[model samples]
Target: MARIRVLTALKIKRNLKPGMYADGLGLYLKVRPGNSKSWIFRYRTGGKLRDMGLGPFHTVSLAEAREKAEVCRVMRLKGLDPLNERLKEQQAKTIEAIETITFEKCAEGYIAAHKAGWKNGKHADQWTATLQTYVYPVFKDKPVAAIDDTLVLKVLQPIWRDKTETASRLRGRIERILDWARVMKYRAGENPARWKGHLDHLLPKRSKVAAIVHHPALPIDETPGFFQILRQEATVVARAFEFCILNATRTNEAMGMRWDEYDEQAQLWTVPGVRMKAGRDHRVPLAQRSQRILAQMQEIRTGQFVFPGGVQERPLSSMAFLMLLRRLERKDITAHGFRSTFRDWAAERTDFSNEVVEMALAHTISNKVEAAYRRGDLFDKRRQLAEAWAAFCAGTAPSKP
Candidate 1:
């Protein structure tokens, strides 16, 4: 039997306790111990009992609860669970809505998934360091969905002028993480880090930023004295630096030098395309001094790399050369500046063409027309240049050779 529907005016004065009072039409008043009353509907779907809350007593009057109950009763009769259907609808709405996933979380997930694909562990560390230093402090707590152009500008604008190269990489990384978040349903919309039509106008071109000034090379006359001082240092790093200068190669290329890359018979060091900066195989014509250094390194070689670090298996760190230079009190000259020194000596002292000099340094000349026509490596000209430079370092000339 169903009870008569009591008007709110009577129920408000009566102060009902925690229990359900049938109010007819499948609607009932559920009162709490605190005397708060809410409207609920009791019904069955596929022999299963279900209770659905309609509204609070104060919000929905007895008349309104009755109307809502009739709708639920109809829904129940149609083979639907009113409670289950309501929950499903809520979940669907949640899926469509954008929510905040912090930048820190997104970056962590990104690094964990993609670190293995990086060329080296240092590459992974570099990516993490940039985000930790520049991006995380600005957007760590902020939801990825809430980040906009204004927030992104705050991160980039400070270093955009001074550290353009690093800032450029940071911008690309930010865009990648946001794109990943969107694909994972954490956020959705256009990527704010995009530079094409958006940030291009707002910021100066990265190329236009002031070029980083490195320590200039010592004058050509100072080469003999510098080489003499470098030779006095007995560390493997000093030997490596000497080898780098003799070959005119970058520090990274030298650090990762492998014994297998050398061919004693061919008298050449073949740096693989993966290790070369231009991503092409580079053949360095071995000078007399370079050959001597390799022969000396063979006594210590226990693994793949010629200049293995203290750990035995790994290559010497890129900083190893710089630290050695600092110890010699010649920190004014950079390890890379030796290439400039070699170039200066070649241009001022030798009769070799610019192509020969550039080839010796393993630099890619960008003149497309000339590059297309000039396929030969000028190996004979380079051999003469390398021998001449080695002679200059040894304080002798070709007349003596």
Candidate 2:
């Protein structure tokens, strides 16, 4: 037997004090704080309680709310989920609005929304470039809703193996655009460009398709010889490259170093959070050789930057180190590969702890538990390590502690 309806139209009109008023058969008229009112349908499904919203009391009358509740009750009796069914009906209505937006329009909208927050300016250009080059030719004019798995496969399949890296990046961009489309109600259903569980079955893994290639690095023993040649060059780029190798800093860090970042008395160069790859401030201890470079840099320093380009105010171009390498006729090795050279030298020849070496390179600690306990930066220990690295590059023995 069903319970009698506890709430009437008159009762709902009079009582408005922030509480649930039952209408029986899983229908409820709830009053919220500040005298707001709404209808809810509560039911148990698969041993879990679920509450689905009906229309608000001001819009839906008692009889109308009861009618919606009855439909939901009937759905449960037939072993279907009414809440999920309601969503499907709502989604169908949303698709009616989505059909007008095309894939290209949606992709442009997504890029526009995200461009400001992206770190690199080239990233914004790449988003439009990749889509224009590959994806736009196929689906540019088509409605986002019309992009199915088959259509997406048609766009990706030809380049999947031959241009594996580009194809992988394209697939990710397509998936992100499709996801944004779904959220904006310009599309519906599962993302057709999704890789895991969907496209994984269709295409081979990117690793299997693309050959692995590492950046060329100088052999550990060969660094001192290279350093000797590097020291002889009078160019700012040469000095920057030598600073990069000594501190195990990236090219950007070396080139972007400014006058304010250095503490002359403390002998530390602090890379601010904004400039660092991990978005954390990294303190690089100045070795005797690095300090000597800084002293020479100060004598000729034109503007704010330690390594000025042709213009005094601006830092060196990002390609400066690579061009320097090319000029030296050592085109086989990249500027970034110097970090690996530092790591190799540390592992093979030094007695310093691995943490100190990694810290010198400003690599993020991967072990969470170990990192948590390491509250101190071990700057003194790292100073010793940096000094040793400098001595090694100078073709001298590290002084015994």
Candidate 3:
């Protein structure tokens, strides 16, 4: 009941045509247009066909190709698309010759590999600064494979108590680098930087770390006063901030809003999954004030962004909204905390259920069991909630002290 293996080294050598199907999922050892022999591994992921180029046949042997196909098959079984993780195969080839791969090298490679996906250079800059300042001093040149949990804790322990947020992000970055190294065949075994089961036992819970006060939400009653103040200013930054408050969108989401994403007829703003924090395309129901802000931005729109900055082809600076808040004399509250403010208003002032409010905020449900049972199809209700919140903020006067 087993299919005979017909495509061997001799067969590949003789019949190097452009269309030679070999192994599982349409794995083909074929010649490209110019007779450059290549192997392409095709597999189905999420009901879609994906072709993964294995390598040139001249360099890749039959046994090696089979080995890679097996790895992809295993990944597919675990619900991971090997196409996304193509670096694994590419790195494995060059990595075996590298005996002493350093953590710094891996860290740099990780940043280089992923920095393109980040919205701006600030994220890469932060990664570089943290690694150079905190991690490099400890074990930057050390062989990444030899890095143990003890080493990870050593880097984190000094700042864990004093600089909780930085330390937390540092630990996660270390973990990701180690993971990347492992996948690239530079290291092996359990990830020492992982926090869930391993490092959680080593360090105090993040929630218990009280040194850094995270985004402090403005009081629900004070939001209207703040919104009115923001509206008084005629600057584009102020208009962007007003739009943010009215829609309850994140700072990046608000700043990164594209002209093409807004549909006037539908009164909808379709935020591509790449731009969203939840990593899913979100359909935001634009309120009257939000629509008005869009219309205002259209009058002075430059490039693709709804809120373009001084720099060409760039949105507003990452700190633009923060600086706006500081000018408004509200440095105590963050732009991000507006989501919490909106949640508070929804729960206390209105009869809207928590689910609708959460949908409006684009908060992905964490509980798998709860998520599986509940269908997140509360768009119409969220529209009503958005309109109500807009009316309360724009129409009503600030609450009397």
Best by lDDT: 2
- Report how far off residue 223 is in candidate 1 (Å): 1.4
| Model 2 lDDT per residue over 284-360, tens place | 88998899999999999889999999975999999888888888999999999988988988887878888888888
Candidate 2 or 3, higher TM-score? 2
Task: Please report, as a residue range, the 10-residue window in candidate 2 with the lowest summed lDDT.
Answer: 392-401
Regions more than 4 Å wrong, model 1 = 1-99, 161-166, 179-190, 205-211, 364-381, 396-401
For residues 3-55, write the lDDT of model 3, one tens digit per residue: 43447777677745566556554566777666678777788877888888889
Candidate 1 least-lDDT 10 residues: 392-401
Is 1 or 3 the stronger prediction by TM-score?
3
Candidate 1: Cα lDDT at 114: 85
Per-candidate TM-score against the hidden true structure = 0.67, 0.72, 0.71
TM-score ranking, high to low: 2, 3, 1
- Measured with C-alpha atoms, the lDDT of residue 365 in candidate 3 is 95
Ten-residue segment with the worst summed lDDT in candidate 3? 392-401
Candidate 3 lDDT score relative to the true structure: 0.84
Comparing candidate 2 with candidate 3, which one achieves the higher lDDT?
Answer: 2
Model 1 C-alpha lDDT per residue in residues 181-229, reported as the tens digit of each score:
8887888789899899888988989879858666578788888888888
